[model samples]
Target: MHRLAIALLLIGGAGTAQAAGIRCDGGLVDRGDLQIEVLDACGEPDFRDDWAAGSLPAGVVAPDVTQWTYNFGRGNLLYILRFRNGRVIGIDNDGYGFDADNTSEDCGPTDIVPGMTKYRLLSACGSPAQRDSRVVLRSSRHFRYGVAEQIRRETWIYNFGSRRLLRKVILENGRVVRIDTDNRGFD
Candidate 1:
């Protein structure tokens, strides 16, 4: 480990702390002590772009941003990758036009029904907003202003003999009119 690595590890809080397995040399980013790496078509190069390129810019309204920003045009997409012990733990993808008002509401524990199959849940939600190896839960709320948003919720579910959804749920939101899975699945 070099001084930059050590310094980053020290500055990064213990809360985001991840195992040493994640490369801390130069490819990794230490935030709140959590080791995060963003991967895309270009491969994992040193994270160099200014944070502002995305939603959170330094000294800006956003104080907490975990990933570096990548923009090619209207197709600009922001992503966050979590690593545990140097291996990827989780990945988050966000594109432009993302807004808080249009964000997905938290399902909490009340949203899930045990022994629920992907097929069953898909029917209940009218159609799957999105699906992967994880479970899919989406909700539509119409505000008084006539504006509406579709909140896309994710829970990793497996389709095999076990055929079960994982415990935790990853929740996200998108425009109400544009509710369709972009085919982002672990498979």
Candidate 2:
């Protein structure tokens, strides 16, 4: 009885460590799969973004990270896949999705809030009227060696026509960090 209990606990722990996989067109896309393989299995993603991560030490190269978001419709949750060096490293679920063609009518600028992922913001508010992005590097002394990290900072402006106020969203590393309201929008 003791041995059986120990084996069951080990099995449960192992299961928790495994990454979650997603099903795409009857195919299973899991961690360690190549970018092409996921594209083939899942078809084109609804939205995609690329950024860089990892510590930048002297003469060391940082890994390029790509994130692809798939929206299965209003009934299913959106899945965001992260790839590093052309291989899938993580899969995460955001909020519920909306119809691809009907996305623009789903929500408005008021729905956007801080802590929402880029995918969720896009799903809720559609595309921004204007976008600007830049990389901000900061040094960390906590590491054994001096290292610099690159953070992607983005500013998105939304024009909701003549009635609603304009919104300015600030995102850092693909997550909304702040939102500001500006003057009224134009046609």
**Best lDDT goes to which candidate?**
2
Instruction: Kindly report which residue stretches of model 2 are placed more than 4 angstroms away from their true locations once superposed.
Output: 1-19, 52-60, 138-144, 161-165
Each prediction's Cα lDDT score? Answer: 0.30, 0.74
lDDT of 1 by residue, 16-95 (tens): 22223223234543323333333422244222211121232234332222333222223333333443344444333323
Clashing pairs in 2: none
Model 2 sits at a Cα RMSD from the real structure of 8.6
Summarize candidate 2's per-residue lDDT along 69-139 as a digit string, tens digits. 87777666667788889999977666555676665565677688888889778767878999988766666
Weakest ten-residue segment in model 2 by summed lDDT: 1-10
Tell me how far the alpha carbon of residue 138 in candidate 1 is from the true structure, in angstroms, after superposition.
15
